[model samples]
Target: MELLLAVIPPLLCYVIFSLCKIGFQKRDQRCYMLSYQCHKAPEDQKLDTGSCADIVTRNKNLGIEEYRFLLRTMVSSGIGEETYCPKNVIDGREESATHMDAVSEMDGIIFQTLDKLFAKTGVSPSEIDIIVSSVSLFSPAPSLTARLINRYRMREDVKAFNLSGMGCSASVVAIDLVKQLFRTCKNSLAIVVSTESMGPNWYSGKDKSMMLSNILFRTGGCSMLLTNNRALKNKALLELTCSVRTHIGSIDEAYRSCIQVEDDLGHKGFRLTRDLPKAGAKALAMNLRVLLPKVLPPLEMLRYVITYYRNKIMKRSSPKGAGPGLDLKSGIDHFCVHPGGRAIIDEVGKSLALSDYDLEPARMALYRFGNTSSGGLWYVLGYMEAKKRLKKGDKILMISLGAGFKCNNCVWKVLKDLDDTNVWQDCIDHYPPSTIGNPFSAKFDWINDESMDFARREDYLPLLKKHSR
Candidate 1:
């Protein structure tokens, strides 16, 4: 009897120890998103089609060809008249490209976003154990994270990371970094800030490829607070489940698809080559190869495998287009697609077989805010929240494409029904507008006329005035 009693106590202790270890492991993997804030620039910073045309007129390097290209791109970009630009661009000082302009622009966005985030979450800056900031085109001397630490008076031992050149996928990459850190740091809080600096990187060159950036990118940013604290679980809006990233930078074509280079005239610009769409498609396919299995339901996975083989066996006799892809709707409830541009959003939507409802947030975000680079995804998510599309237990998939020919995607489980209007406060009601057409094409389509003189600025003044009214 005594022998059996002794064994029982030790066995019980071992089972208890195993349970505790498993509990701790699960806790370590927990990452909760408490709150997020998207920056809204003042009314004075709004960039309309007229302001854009005026800026183009000021650029002596551009001819009629460039003007027509810009107009065509702006008309089809899926951006609206209310998008904001840096103060320098608003003031017609784009060519100056001063360091102060870049700093001030970032300061305006980061400070406002952080301020609002703190207010909404009621979380003190001192509680932040880690800080991650991403700005693809700008990395100043002191670094953006250092600037935040100085401005917020954060703790001396706070961990800080400033990521540059990661492109639009940077925010997802930042979240992945925080998730990894959460595994080692218990009960920790982290803040992530994502934005792009347009002032210094504004392309003055007439390279048609480079000028595309000017028409598409705009001023915006976002700040998010995340925590692994079990106490804050109820307060979290979403719980990040997984993140997957794919990069094709080693391929020659993909590597050169999007890059920052100096034009023949020694003017710096970001070039988007014709190969970009192909590169993005390839990267997305590779990323989904790993990601879909993790998130898709078992039956959905089986359906995909069967369909894939069925198509492969009939390859020679099959039609031109590949048959329908996996049904993401089976598992995901909401999609926060990055609003890179009109064509990008359209292509991704078609490939995923998403409904108009799934594509609305991306389209509306692009129309309302233009492309804010890494920060763009958050704006799309904000749109979903404002429309009250998110519900408790629903899953949201976020997909972001970046310059390294990289595609980064992640999934979030909504903690509750979120209805924050965020940066879309004044404009959410009018979203999914009747149409996203811009006035640029109507006013400047005349530039495309072969008979029109390409060189004289004075000759266009009367037309410009006529269109202005």
Candidate 2:
């Protein structure tokens, strides 16, 4: 009887251990977005409309209508005066920089951003288990992965990946890749860097479709640190809850919507066709069709299903299906829609039935920083953080459209109340202004040179003189 009692206790302990082992192995792997940093270019690179017109006219490749389209697009495109240009491609340069110049610019951006991020998180370079980077336009020998490794002197066994040609959605793609790796790597760290090499890819060609690239693509990058280390949850900013990706490259028209080609004049440029928004909407719908079922509240999903069935299956009157319209706010608290362009933002917001408040971050990011390609979503998030709009348990939907007709969506839950010190600290207070619209069309009499002089005398002179050495 004594032997039997001892066996019983040991067997119970074994059973408990086995159950815990199974539970731990089966538990979902959690990925945390610890922190991110954006590289703010120097002020000299700001390209206003007048400078853009001068550059286009000097290129001598575009005709009158093309120039007019660029100017009109610039005015209504949501890009403000703060979008930057590479030093080699700034106004009056006559020629954009060579491939090596692009490499140099990217090197500086990537290094600086990573340095800032590490300093912020206090995560050692040696602690990073994986390195993933995405740059859409340029790829050289030794690869960007090699450059990062050599620059940071990361561990020799650290796995590295350099993703190219994926375009703007590449950042989330890199995030998804890192999340998948975290499943096996245990409590390890991954660094995802997204930036563009714009100098070499500048189009001097006459193709109207191709020239759109020159006007919209700008210089920027972001570095993000993600980890599966549960101990770091207190310091982490967000928990990645869901990731969804859809690729429609098989469709011929969608595939050609954004493509890189050598123009008739043999100048290389990316062609962004007019049909891009329509194709992107379709792709976004397909992604959400799968994603909404998983993340949306039950009633919201039922409403969408009922509306969809009544319109298509029940042959009832379908009012909003004729255009983009859906009440996604019922499920999502905040959205980080890709600020690819003004038209794209408008179309996606309309399709999703998002209010102006829901879109303020994206619009403000575009207005303040132009499209930063793969890093654009991070800028939108930065704007939200800067404004202190996020709250714990709020759901943030991050969606981006890229080349290869791709749509990527990631859902995140705010882990805690985020601090105000972020990338947008310098300009947050100046934004989401008293009014919101196309900055070019908006009339502000008080902002003229005369009014500005009065403000300088009344407000700025004392501060300037006090601080001036």
C-alpha lDDT score of every prediction, in listed order: 0.89, 0.82
The digit string of per-residue lDDT tens for model 1 on 1-469 reads 9999989999999999999999988877899999998988999999987788777777888776777787888888988889999899889898897999999999999999999899888889999999999999898889999999999999998999999899989999999999999998889999999999998888898999999999999999999999999899999999999899899999989989989999999989889999999999899889998998999999999987887788788783534333247788788888889999999998888777777889999999999899999999999999999988899999999999998889999999999889988777888898788887988768777776776665576776557656744
Residue-wise C-alpha lDDT for candidate 2, range 205-239, written one tens digit per residue: 77888988887888899999998888888989899
Give me the displacement of residue 426 in model 2, in angstroms. Answer: 2.0
Model 1 clash pairs are: none
Give the local distance difference test score of model 1.
0.89
**TM-score, cand. 1:** 0.94
Model 2, C-alpha of 47: deviation from truth (Å): 1.9
List candidate 2 segments past 4 Å from native: 1-22, 26-28, 91-96, 306-314, 321-327, 434-469
The list of candidate 1 runs beyond 4 A from truth reads: 1-20, 314-324, 453-455
Winning candidate number (TM-score): 1
Report, for all candidates in order, the number of backbone clashes.
Answer: 0, 0
